[model samples]
Target: MRIYLPTTLALLAEQHAAGAVLVPDGAVVAEDDSEDAEYAALMTAADASAVQLAGAGRRVVVVADLAAEPAVGAAVPWREVVAVHADVEDRPAGADPDEDLAWFATQEVPDLF
Candidate 1:
């Protein structure tokens, strides 16, 4: 199952160093394999990321695939991360949170920070 983990850049850096990001329960999960479903999931995750942002920063979503549905408080290993979706530029304060995110490959994750 694919999971979208809402997170912040600071946290992302920590995760990068730690090699895994601990995920909370009830994270975004697509209902089906359809593109629309996955998109909805990503949007939902972006919203959740906004809430967590609480201040100036771009939205971020960690895309990872797990063996099965994740349990409560699961940890996503860095190796499991396939891609990252984040704002190409930091959104201005009070800017539209609906701004789209850019896709970055896992190898490019280090350059994101």
Candidate 2:
């Protein structure tokens, strides 16, 4: 299953350093098994990310492919992360609600800091 996990920049940095991120209870997943279903999940995750924001940083959604359906609360290894969707820049507090997140490959995750 493919899941979208929304997280704050500080928590992400800690997880990146630890080599895995804990899947939140609020993580977003498609209603069905289909590529098309993932987009809505991603957008939902993005919106959830916005609520998690504090201070200043980009909203991040980590995209991971799992071997089997995950049980909501587990750790996703850093290696499992295939891509990331994040705000292009550190927006001011209360930035535009409709601004789009930029797509980035897993390899570029470090440079995002």
Candidate 3:
């Protein structure tokens, strides 16, 4: 399953370097069929990161692919992040409701911090 993580640019870099993104707490934020579902989840994560803006200026949506075995539920506890979609290159600065996320591709994220 493909999951979208709302995080900072620096944290993304750290995850990239570490080869894993760790989810210490909170619910698993991911994309659903509804475009609204995907957007809402992403926005919720971005909103949560507003307090920690010093490390990275813009909110980043990390697209990761996890194995289909583990289902997301109250009983499931996810920790390490493994595979990431290698298509999305960059995340734009600031929030824009007009910006379309469907076009995001796999590539190196630009220095937005």
Off by over 4 Å in 1: none
lDDT of 3 by residue, 1-113 (tens): 54555555676676655555544233245656576886676555555444345332544555455565333321222233432222133433454434433323334343333
Clashing pairs in 1: none
lDDT, candidate 1, 1-113, per-residue tens: 78888888888999889999778543798888889998888889888887788877888899998877677677788999989999877776677866778999999988889
For all predictions, the C-alpha RMSD in Å is 1.4, 2.0, 6.5
The TM-score of predicted model 2 comes to 0.85
Q: What TM-score, computed on C-alpha atoms, does each candidate reach? A: 0.91, 0.85, 0.52
Rank candidates, TM-score, best first.
1, 2, 3
Candidate 3 Cα errors over 4 Å, as ranges: 24-31, 54-56, 67-104, 110-113
lDDT for each residue of candidate 2 in 1-113, tens digit (9 for 90 to 100): 78899987778888989999889867987778776787788888987888888656789999888886566668899999989899888888788867778998988888887
- Using lDDT as the measure, what is the rank order of every candidate, best first? 1, 2, 3
Give me the displacement of residue 1 in model 1, in angstroms: 1.2
Location of the lowest summed lDDT over 10 successive residues in candidate 3? 69-78
TM-score of candidate 1 relative to the true fold: 0.91
How many angstroms is residue 88 displaced in model 1 relative to the true structure, after the best TM-score fit? 1.2
